[model samples]
Target: MKPAPFLLTALFSAAVSAAPATHMDTKAATEAVSVYYRNPNPDRALKIMQTIIADPLWKKDSARHNLSVWAAQILRQHPQATDKWCRAMKQYPAVTQDETAYFFFLANTSESRKCLRNLNISNHSKTYIAQNTPPDISSLSNISPADLDALWTTFYATGNPKAVEKVLDRVLDYAKAQKAQEKSNHKNIDMTGVAAAWSARSNIMQNQDIRKIFDTYLNRLNATDKALLQKILVQE
Candidate 1:
């Protein structure tokens, strides 16, 4: 007869645990977490996550980097996990400095900043966070070149495509505004080509959906902007 469901789960866990930390596949672990970490209670999910992270395998740089990136993604999804996540991240301060720095740069709210501040990160990360938290994009209508520039900085720092999307939205809006006015002038932002140019710099644009966002708005830009974008894309 087949073993019970609990017995199967125990056996699987044991199989994974029996592998040496260095031999464990980081991608496999991350994929498993994404698939199975769906507990409704954030605390319970955090507990399960903590169990995995506690493995000696995470002492390696590659594993720790994956863990930190996963931590940032989870925090973005579930801000309620803040206190627990910070406490957990504390256990690997030496390796988390870059992760925490990127997290602080992308943090958009006071509460998010506070949670990042609570982490026991290194002085280098602390200084970078204090100097580089992005300004709030409170009003897209009044968005400035500085705002788009900051988002690009975050994109390069974290390789998150959503940042490029934000720039694309702003450029599209500005293009539409100019088309309505029959004039291509704006606040000297030169943003018409930014989304296409910067997005091309990263391999992440391989996502057809992201590339589609640029194409969807291409017809909306004025002739001048279109020519500039085409030139930039070719040059980039």
Candidate 2:
């Protein structure tokens, strides 16, 4: 009996998507930050964010915990208020120091860089980051896909074949798992159904981030790996 392709696709997609997602902020707050990234024009992102946070939802002390990265950026411009910043960051557990540091890193403002340097990150985090500043390729698949994407994006900020290789390897790991499903299950039955999709209707290469890496690192992959990618991507 043939299983309809969409059902498998949807089931696999749902499994992949079911990974615990980082909490999100209001749509307005998200757009404000995305707007800045797309354009990066002078003060517009900041001004837009400033306006968005002024919404009544943001004013309530109880709701302040949901403040997004966009709101945090506007707050970054305020005069040094360590106590306030501490309290606010404490409240919004979702708005992480990693997000904040990465935001400043992307912003590339002198003040923002200073803020990153001052972040109260632990020594363990500092060492892990220093070791994996470029991010290790061999271990990419061990983390959640969201973290994988974030790390890939960070490494892509300064593109290299090594980083691209890591991204492709992570994708390949799952694809191979799909191929090796019969063998992988004996080790872990509870998650075998969800850890890897049997097939992908959507070529992962279609994703812009992944596509960029594919285009950049196509030659670096061996013939066998390339063939595997073609299968996973549903290409002839």
Candidate 3:
């Protein structure tokens, strides 16, 4: 009753793959931050950021922008450590222009503002920050398209049920807005909400919690959108 050779090989492979890496890559960091949003491991999360921020890939706007959001989200959980967060970011002087702009926009606290002031952020980014109002993640009523995009990205990054619920709330909000526009006799109603929900089909199909959300909200959608979603759910 010994294990077969192929089974032994598979077990060995699994054990090797399960071993933790010395440093977190971009995808791994993204996942770590996503989980940190819920679990709030300030020390390990900050260490992960310290590791990945040194990589040149993080200088790219896409990664930096997500980092800004993720960092801000993590900070929200640690209200008392705003100064600590600022100190950590100060170590990275090579932060890109896009990172400067996004981080500046989310830096509502005085300590955060001072941290950015001391950093090597470009004058143009400073001007942009000064001229425009910083986005308030706390206020969903005034959430811009960009912020909504970030929310959906967070849901995809973590697959957390809470993240799923946040996206569902936005989807329902968009549906409501679409209906409001239609009532005003607008010829071209924007179905951004429906489109957002449709875009989440693959993610929803893959997760049980997300699938339950899809089911709960299915009947809430208008006939056309609901039918379209039902068709895809069955076919896919």
Q: Which structure among the candidates has the greatest lDDT?
A: 3
Give the higher-TM-score candidate: 1 or 2: 1
lDDT of 1 by residue, 182-227 (tens): 5545444445334434544332243444466466555777787775
Give me the displacement of residue 100 in model 1, in angstroms.
3.0
Pairs with backbone N, CA or C atoms under 3 Å apart (clashes), candidate 1: none
For model 3, where is the 10-residue window of minimal lDDT? 1-10
Candidate 3 per-residue lDDT over residues 1-236, each given as its tens digit: 00111111122223235435643364465455534534556566667666556655455445556556656555555546666656666655544433543553564666566666666666667777778765554455543445555565455334445555555666656555655576576555444454455545645654555677677777677887675555544444
Task: List where candidate 1 sits over 4 angstroms from the true fold.
Answer: 1-77, 93-118, 121-133, 137-162, 165-198, 201-205, 234-236
Q: What are the per-residue Cα lDDT tens digits for candidate 2 across 1-236? A: 00111222232233234423431334434333322433443345444434434444344322232223233333344424333443433333333454334334333345554655667655654554445443233355564433333333333223334544554555576666666765564644323223232222232432354455566555567888777766655463
Candidate 3 deviant stretches above 4 angstroms:
1-24, 94-101, 141-145, 153-166, 169-195, 206-209, 212-236
Clashes of each: 0, 1, 0
lDDT for model 2 comes to 0.41
- Model 1: residue 43 alpha-carbon error in angstroms: 10
> Which ten residues in a row are the worst by lDDT in model 1?
1-10
Q: Give the per-residue Cα lDDT of candidate 3 at 200.
A: 54
Task: Give per-residue lDDT, candidate 1, residue 136.
Answer: 47
Candidate 2 vs 3: which has more TM-score: 3
